[model samples]
Target: MKFTYKIDEKTELKMLDLQESEQLFYLTIGSKETLREWLPFIDFTQKVTDTQNFIQSTMKQYSENNGFQAGIWYEGKMAGVIGFHKIDWNNKSTSIGYWLSNDYVGLGLMTKSVKAFIDYAIKDINLNRVEIRAAIGNKKSRAIPERLGFTEEGCVREAEWLYDHYVDHVVYGMLAKDWLNKNKIKRV
Candidate 1:
């Protein structure tokens, strides 16, 4: 699958690679406390090598058509990462995951990037369903799905393991038919 997505003049999503692991590692380390609150894997990435291994694994997954992770770029800098956890080819569904740098919050960059990916998933990839799961109390993360018009399907109690404890996850879902209809009206 193609890896790069140009959302606009200032925003793009590019497939992450091993060479960029150091940069990604530093970003994660810098945002350790903030990111760790919601992401459990952050605790395992102790050094650059771990980041390299993670990126390498993701690259392999991309080749196998399982899933992918892309670095979100804003104004030519790595702002965050976003992508599908996996594509359920049988069910024509997928789940999205993402995180933004502390500095990039409130810029509407993530919302736009996510919207672009959802468009690609539904229109280009022909996916029937796309889902996002945000840890409970993560208003910032939850807002992306809400702003894009996904339905709040409910929550899974203690669904995600953060650093210290489990956190409930609010599930949001959107169907391609609904997204298509919405976009058609927008284009009219």
Candidate 2:
């Protein structure tokens, strides 16, 4: 949310290029063309306004709240969105959310992005816990956490209302210590 923590546009472009090899995608905060590509997804309909509103509001929230948000770039284009919500510096915790356009499905791009973001949050920001919650029945949504070594902490019944009626959510979490340990192995 600091607005100061920008991933360099050039680097972001390069990341998008690398992501293309893996079928990942991203969009800048206010890119109408990018958001347009994401609109067909059910998740975007819930909270996203138009390009102007989303960019203005999200930038404001990131500045005011000290949070992080980024576009998911895939195939050299913006294909999705991801961010850390409800960041608490005092508590050292935050919730993560993401959505991918259907065009980018069936690849492990989300998992790679999640791992990259988790590394940034824990190692760079010094956060303790990163949490992820997926709507019930969203197996693909939950798969990122499962692949990233997050614990399946259980479900919260009727926790979020999306698309229509209320829906249960499956929670997943990874602690800083666990991530550090995992890194040692990966480094080796």
Candidate 3:
């Protein structure tokens, strides 16, 4: 089945398939230096086949009801990827991960895309909580969750290994009730 979610007329999220792996690889290549600063897995993706393997794994995640990663297409071009990490069903919670090509920054694209994911997690999937964690020094990445009104829960000291060193993360969380209330959505 086809999986697509439109964030707006100019942007949409589509589940990645093997055929689009090359495009994704190129996007990563173009943004490598910048992406590597905040994302730990960038070094692991040194080839197109790595991207394909990622897609295949995400497909498995979808089939197993874990969660899926999706390509963020902007005006029909592969701009980035955003996805829910493996879900904690018992807790009705999940986290989101995203990266945009350096070329696509500052266009309000990530903000819009994240809003859509939050809506899906809360309204579509009946999830109770959504969280985002970003390296403390990565302002741009942290802004998405902040702009979307997620609460700054706290910090995890040296939470991730970037490449050679550790980077602390600022945790942001949004509960379904708070998100719905903020959006003025009432549950039936």
Q: Cα-based RMSD of the predictions, in order?
A: 2.1, 7.1, 1.2
Model 3, runs deviating above 4 Å: 186-188
Clashes of each: 0, 12, 0
The residue-by-residue lDDT of candidate 2 on 1-188, one tens digit each, is: 13222333421212122223222312322333433332233335333244435555556656676665666655546656677776898999988877656566666667766776787788877889999998777777888999888999999998876545677889999999899898763321
TM-score per candidate, chains pooled: 0.95, 0.73, 0.97
Model 3 C-alpha RMSD vs. true structure (Å) is 1.2
Off by over 4 Å in 2: 1-49, 185-188
lDDT of 3 by residue, 77-157 (tens): 999999999899999999999999999998898998899888888988899999999999999989999889999999999
Residue 43's C-alpha lDDT in candidate 3? 92
Pairs with backbone N, CA or C atoms under 3 Å apart (clashes), candidate 3: none
Q: All candidates' lDDT scores?
A: 0.90, 0.63, 0.92
TM-score of 1: 0.95
Candidate of highest lDDT: 3
